[model samples]
Target: MELFEGRPADCSGRQEREVRVYDLLDRLGIAYQRTDHVPAGTMEDCDRIDAVLEVTICKNLFLCNRQKTAFYLLMMPGNKAFRTKDLAAQLGVARLSFGTPEDMLRLLDVTPGSVSVMGLMNDRDNQVQLVIDRDVLKGERIGCHPCLNTSSLRFATSDLLEKVLPAMGHSPILVNL
Candidate 1:
């Protein structure tokens, strides 16, 4: 895949949700680089995208508490293993399991393969909390999907933490795991 700056010039076939991501980031004045590729459902699939984008695409997970009341969006290194018990103690939550696609779509307006921190923009009700792994925060840049796995985007870590998160009314909880 070739890296393109900002949104695709020709958005003819792009999904509305993907275009919305570009619109939001552009309006926020957050600089980013983008690349279009096949739908990547697994980390192995993202490896190619990561190589071309030159940044590891964060493994974004949509999770919910057992009762399904509390929802969270987790961003971590693709290589890192997720341990619920470890994250549970940090969040003071009893347990966390993969959120269903139904809840993911209802709250984040995203599907399984496209779960991203950018989707936090759709959570206007603040139903989903944002969580970032320390390792990811330390990076100068991070990559994520535009609420669609067919494409990925890269931007400064600071822009995401300082500009995007605040703009979305989200205060991310940093966890180490």
Candidate 2:
């Protein structure tokens, strides 16, 4: 895959969700690099893309409380081992589980295998809390799926935290893990 600056000139055949991500970034005046590839669901599939982007693509998890009333979007180092018990303690919440595909779609406008911070744009209700790893914020740049597993995007970490998240009405709670 090759990286191109900003939105694709020809977005004609792209999924609407993907297109919306690009549109939001452009509208926010945030520059990004993009590459198209086969849908990536595993780290092995992402290694090549990660190499090209020169940043570890954060692993995004869609999680919810036992009642499913509170939802969270977590961005963490792809290599970091995740332990629900650990995260639950940090967030002061009861047991958390992977959100269902149905809630993922309803709130984020994204299906399984394609969760990212970009999806927060669709959560106008601010129902989903953004939880990001402190390590992720330390990176100068971050790579992530553009609400579609078939494509990936790289953007300045500052733009995401300072501009994008605020615009999306998401104030991330930084976690060390």
Candidate 3:
């Protein structure tokens, strides 16, 4: 797969999820800044990445309501703490918990570390909902993994909302948290 360095690696030779995201971005006419780094899913890991990418990485969580009927992909500022009670109250759900890895793979076609908004593309059934934190929306550019944890992509937040999400048949729900 492409390293997400300045140059585009030969993606044709790769058949990974990251390659698919890159292809989608290219087809959508969205320009982006990509940077390769170590795998990061926590604040400390994101801190190192932020130093290199000059942008905060979002905390992408896969969750389900108490009944497991409603699934969500919540993207928020990595540094922010997750308060389940607060989210449950705002969402009007009884309770929420991290979905199992099996559920994530079945519903979003993604593994744990590689969870991302781009995974929404796999949810053709519209089983998963997207929730974006208000703070993350304040930035002009949003950084996320390309369906893989090894590298990251930076693109205009507007492009993601206006083009990518629509193309994937999903719209993000903006929430303050």
Candidate 4:
């Protein structure tokens, strides 16, 4: 894989959602680095992408309560072990489960493998609450997909916390797990 300064010069075959991410970042004046690769479906694939980007890509989880009334996007380190009970306790929710692909698409406009904090831009209605792990905030830079698994992006964590998330109108709920 190769790293590019910003959005691909030729977006011919790229997904519209992917381009929109670039558009938003550009409008926000958030400088980022991007790398295009095949859809990342496994840890090995992500590790390779991480090596190229020089940052560990976050493991973004789309979760919902049993009734599906509350939706959340949890961002954490890719290598961290996730326990639903741990997060549920932190949120005071009885249970938390992975959201369905349909809900993921309807709410965040991203599929299972493509879930990322960037997808929160599509949640204009504030349907999904952003949940971030404390450890994720310790990093100087954040790595994530651009609403699609075929590419990944690296940018300042401060830019995400100070600029991007605020511009998207979503306030993140920081948690320990």
Give the candidate number with the greatest lDDT.
Answer: 4
Better of 2 and 3 by lDDT: 2
Task: Give per-residue CA lDDT, model 1, range 73-95, as digits (tens).
Answer: 99999999999999989999999
| Candidate 3, 42-131: lDDT as tens digits | 667777777666778788999999889999999999878999888878888889999999999998888998899989888999999999
- Please give the lDDT score at residue 90 for candidate 1: 97
* lDDT (Cα, tens digit) per residue for candidate 2, span 117-174: 9999999999999999899988999999899999999999999989999999889999
- lDDT preference between candidates 1 and 4, better one: 4
lDDT of each model, Cα atoms only?
Answer: 0.92, 0.93, 0.83, 0.96
* Candidate structures ordered by TM-score, highest first: 4, 2, 1, 3
Model 4 / residue 28 / CA error / Å: 0.4
Q: How many angstroms is residue 41 displaced in model 2 relative to the true structure, after the best TM-score fit?
A: 2.0
Off by over 4 Å in 4: none
Candidate 1, residue 115: how far the Cα is off, in Å: 0.4
In model 2, the runs with Cα more than 4 Å from the true position are none
User: How does each model score on TM-score?
Assistant: 0.98, 0.98, 0.91, 0.99
lDDT of 4: 0.96
